[model samples]
Target: MRNRKLFILLCLLIAVLVIAGCSKTKQTVTQPAETPPAEQTTPPKTDTSTPGSGELKVHFIDVGQADCIFIQLPNAQNLLIDAGNNDDGQAVVDYLSQSGVSQIDYLVGTHPHEDHIGGMDTVFNTFNTGKVYLPKATNNTRTFEDVLKAIKARGLTVTPAKAGVQLVASEGLSAVMLAPNAASYEDLNNYSAVVKVSFGQVSFLFTGDAEEKSEMEMLAGSGAATLKADVLKVGHHGSHTSTSPAFLRAVSPQYAVISAGAGNDYGHPHREILQRLSGIKVYRTDLDGTVVFTTNGQAVNVETR
Candidate 1:
């Protein structure tokens, strides 16, 4: 009887243990898993600057008595400021081709004057131009009309080269228009667009034939103090009519570039303007052939032909 009672107790204990194990197993199988938290992140800023990578290079092409500064962006793209005179259009195209410029990201006709927009039509027809910027002023010259016709032919339109407009050149690089602040001007030179091209810490001021009237307005504008740059493309080709002392003082550039023809009639880089630019390093297109400044954003290396 004692053996039978012991056997029965053992069987009952074994049944209870098995039931408890099954209940625990079922509970564990039915339990829901805990979810993980979502991660936080911010989208990076968009760099809309046209294709470019590597060092930035600015080439002040030797166009006699005219202006045509070709900027090679860090992204390997090109931006032409002006294309010299009408006769120099083919030269600009050939130069670009030799420099491996397959396309022009930006083309700027600072003013409607022939000296600025003369070769613009040829450039527009020769290479694919991305965007063109022109000031509000009009000269009604054949050169200006040619540019307009070319733009229309390319199914493109000109964007007003006004203050505050920005040119996205590349990542960490850009340019902003800083002049032609007024609505009207009697002199076409005063209507020239002044653009400040900056990459990293280095900056360049390209004043397209802007005279005292424009300079005064620029000084009176909001970005007056921001005109400071490492390089200044002297206005009116370093003529007595422009590059006023006040303008020079404000810009305080380390180097000044004057674009003029050798033995030109206007006597560009006039004695008075040269006197004003005494302390600043001056490079004339007539003397330097083609002046090139290459920058790795912070510092620059200048080379001239």
Candidate 2:
């Protein structure tokens, strides 16, 4: 009987050992609970523009003596300064479409002249327009009528092109109208809306066929300071009638761009105007074809096709 009790006690000790071994094995194999991931706070947006792309492209379309400036702002917004002649409407449309332009954030008709606004109607018809800007001066020609009709068709209103008209183009870019300060001018060209565009450390000035009268008025006041720009689109397609010495000195541009047709009877981009821009880097549509300048807010990269 004592032997049997010893066996039973030994069995009980073995069972306890097994229990302890099993508990240790479980503790060794068991893993701690994992923490879940944090929730996102930022809402989703449709902007595909690269935050640090650091480039703004400007396309100077060769419309054969007509003016057309297409700007791709840093914020991915597009701006069309002026359209070419009437026959060049389709060409401008094609160029914009090729450039993958889906919308026009700003449509500016610098003046009521046919060369500046003739193709605007086609642009209005081709792309989704955000806003329209035009000088108060009106013309009785069909080109002007077409633009007005196109704007009406799109159910958009025209904003007066006057001084101090500010535009927030992008996060670091803005444009302001610096001309058409006069309520009325004897010549329509005097009503041209000169725009000054700034981005970071760089700036551009677009003067639309403004002559001495308009320029003098600009110079008489804040024009000296306001006209200064890194680049200047030489006024009146380098016509001798415009781009006076005083205006050039006031602008002090590093680069000058002239859009004029080759072998034109008007003798646009006269030799006298070219001489004035001797110190500035001149890019002409007749010579450079489609001239482009890409800026990284500091340096301008020139590309011509």
Index of the highest-lDDT prediction: 2
Compare the candidates by TM-score and give the number of the best one.
2
Clashing pairs in 2: none
> Per-residue CA lDDT of candidate 2, range 1-305, in tens?
99999999999999999999999887766633221222222223433444534577888899998899998888778889999999999999999999888899988899999999999999999899997899999899989999999999999999998777886656668888888789999989888888888888888998888888888888886559888999998888999988999999999999999999998888999999999999899999999999998898899888999
| Alpha-carbon TM-score of each model against the true structure | 0.82, 0.85
Tens digit per residue, CA lDDT, model 1, 59-178: 999999999999997867678899999999999899999988888989888888888888889999989999899988887778888889999999988899877778875667888888
CA lDDT, every model vs. true structure = 0.87, 0.88
Question: Given candidate 1, what's the lDDT at residue 247?
Answer: 80
Q: Locate the minimum summed-lDDT window of 10 residues in model 1.
A: 34-43
Q: Model 2: how far is 47 from its true place, Å?
A: 8.9
Total backbone collisions, model 1 = 5
